[model samples]
Target chain A: MPREITGFSNPLIKRVRSLRDKKHRRREGLFLAEGLRILAEAEEAGFLPEMLFYARESAEHPIVRRLVRATEAAGGDVIETIPDILHKLSGKENPQTVIGVYPERIVPLSALDRSSADIWIVAQSLRDPGNLGTILRTGDAVGAGGLILIDDCVDPFSVEAVRASMGALFTQTIATARWDEFVSWLRAGPGQLIGTSLNTDQDYQMPTYQRPCFLLVGNESQGLPTTYEKDCDILVKIPMLGKADSLNAAVATAVMAYELLNQRRAR
Target chain B: MPREITGFSNPLIKRVRSLRDKKHRRREGLFLAEGLRILAEAEEAGFLPEMLFYARESAEHPIVRRLVRATEAAGGDVIETIPDILHKLSGKENPQTVIGVYPERIVPLSALDRSSADIWIVAQSLRDPGNLGTILRTGDAVGAGGLILIDDCVDPFSVEAVRASMGALFTQTIATARWDEFVSWLRAGPGQLIGTSLNTDQDYQMPTYQRPCFLLVGNESQGLPTTYEKDCDILVKIPMLGKADSLNAAVATAVMAYELLNQRRAR
Candidate 1:
């Protein structure tokens, strides 16, 4: 039988709630994922949460039981709590019945195998957690190897980002590196650095993406600096048919990624 | 000099702040848009805010000056206010320099010119304001005719949707209709309804999109219903290379929209 915690002041509950903060998440090297679907996805990806908390009301759910069994089998804690505690832990008005605290998986740049996949997503100075998460989903859909964050970007372990990822956080490998280091790594690898830029007259579709394509997107407001664009093997531009000047960063990345995927399929 | 309003209790201030609520906005048939950039985009698209409020500090900004002059020329009210009033109206910790109250523009289904563009975006039961706004931006980028909201969707006039649109709301035409009405409208026109679905074996890129294509996406949680998919001229699926089951709605829409755009460009 799993332990039941009725008190809001439980130490484990407090620690799990603290994971919502970046500083605490970083120090503990753990993050929170909510909802049964997301937790199931994480489990499917071979990740067993260190701590799994489910509402007592949901204790009888088949999926919840499976999760509880798997978690306990892995020497993880399984706790049954009331809705109030679940809500407090989730920080949501209508919180999910289940929430999990999982270890953060950050792959080093050196561990990334360039030849493992045909495409990789790279973002520089990305500020929005939602955009970052959406990009992860896109990367997974397009069969990209992973995401590489260049420079100061939002923490992928942040709750907002993890939630937005919709379980792609587990599906896609995430690595962080500075611009200089990323450039050096790319130079040493067999890859094509393709960037989306407004300065280029080259249409995005006009370029045939080479294998091991690295699709680089810039910051939301400034876009790629001129120097950064100059470093790209080829800079392509998505056409703007209407008065709006640009597509959202994540949207643009998906469009470009699909284009690359389609080109490969056509060949 | 523009009218100076110092008091937060001012009737105009209260009215403007109330526009944030859907009930109040619907009753007034007015919506609020913030930031100089978004407001300028509105102005360039031939929309002049009925009431323009700017912090006294931004009066010297050239774009703000242009906007002030344009509002005055259009016989719209121009008020100079403090940051506190701006903050209250926008509900942001740090608000934009200006806020605009404009009459809501809803293009009826009958008014859309299908032949005006090669592609059109259609969504059924979309609930997220951010997704709605991002779809509008995608539609504009691809040079689609407009966005047609089917069934009961979130109000496009909401501040969250408008902000997420990043000014594309002014560039793209938005229409709302029930599913029956939308089906009737498309059937009467020279349009091919292409839907994204997991039920179809046809890859999204396999089909050559016909001109005046109506790309239909379904609700975020429940994709296009089986009956809805059956109604589509053709159903297509984006290939998922990774373990994730699906892509974000906005991301999927963008990927599909760009594919249609690219097919046209290729032709």
Candidate 2:
């Protein structure tokens, strides 16, 4: 039988709530994956939670019962809590039935399995969590192998990013690298480094993206710096027919990624 | 000389702040465009603001100075306020140096210039303001004719949507229609109605999109209803290689739009 808790002051509840903040999430090396979909994805990806929290009504749902059983089978704790606890954990009026605490799964760039993925995304100093998450989801949609976060990008495990990813966080490989570290890894390349910028006249669709390609994208406001663009094997730009100067970073990435996928599929 | 307002209680300031809410925006027939980039895009699109507000420090900047002069020249009010007033209007701790109030510009489907565009996007019951805005931006990037909003979509003039558009709101033609009304208009066709859904196994890129096509997309949660899909000339799905069941509505729209652009460009 699962433990039942009602108090807001419970130690476990406090710890789970603390996962909402990046500092605490990083320090503890754990993040929360909420809702039935994310929990299911985590389970399918072989990432059972350390703790599973659910409301009484949610636990009554057939899917929640199955998830609870799965968590128990994976040696995870299953706890039943009041709606108020679920609301606190999720910060939504109608919180989802399930929230799981899982360890942060990011690996260093060197540890990434380069053998399987033909394309990789390297995002530099990305500031928005939603864009980072959307890129992850888009990367997964096109079957990109992994994501490399270069420099100080937003936390991929952050709540907003996780939500925007729509559960791709559990399905995709994420790697973090410093500028020097990323550059050296690319130089040891199995593929080309393609960067997108506004300075170039070349249409993004013009390129025949080399396999195992690492597509490097820049920050939202300031695009790729000259130093960074200089390092790329080729630079491309998505044509802008309107007055708006640039596509939103995530949208631009998606256009390029899908174009690459389209090219490969055609061949 | 432009008027300087010192108090937060000013009626004009209150009215500008109220633009944040949909009710107030609709009631007054106005919305806001903030920051230098958006303001510049609006100016370039010939959608000048009715009133311009700026901080004292912002007024000292070259672009702000030019914008203030341009607003005054264009028969619009140019007001200077304290940073707090700008903050309240923007709902950001660090507000942009400038904010502008502009009238809502949506037109009915009957008024859209159908002959000018070879492609358009019809978003059915889109709920997210940000996604709608991104779609607008993406549509503009691909040189699509316009956007059609079906029943109960979020207000395109909402602050979040307008901001997400990054000024594409001014450049793109937006029309609203009911489901029945849209069907009748499609029957009086200038284009083919292409619907995208996961229910179909036909890959999205496989089709040679018909020109002047209307790409119909469903709501975020409940995708295109069978009834809606039944009316489309062709139904297609973006392939999913990973665990995510569906792409974000905006991302899916971008992928389809760009694929069409790529096909056209190749020809």
Candidate 2: TM-score of chain A is 0.97
Q: Compared with the true structure, what per-residue lDDT tens digits does model 1 show for residues A51-119?
A: 999998998899999999999999999999999998998898899989999999988899999999999
Query: Cα miss at A197, model 2 (Å)?
Result: 1.2
Two-chain DockQ for model 2: 0.76
Off by over 4 Å in 1: none
Categorize the docking of model 2: medium
Q: Can you write out model 1's per-residue Cα lDDT over B1-267, one digit (the tens) per residue?
A: 589998999999999999999999999999999998899999998999999999999999999999999999999999999999999999988899999999988888999999999999999999889899999988888898889998878898899899889888888888989888889988997999999999878988889889999999999989988888988999999998888878999999998898898788888
Interface RMSD (Å) of candidate 1: 0.9
Candidate 1 CAPRI assessment class:
high
lDDT by residue (A56-163, candidate 2, tens digit) is 877779778988898888788999999899899888787878888889999997787676877789999999898998999998888998899988899999988888
TM-score of 1: 0.98
TM-score of each: 0.98, 0.97
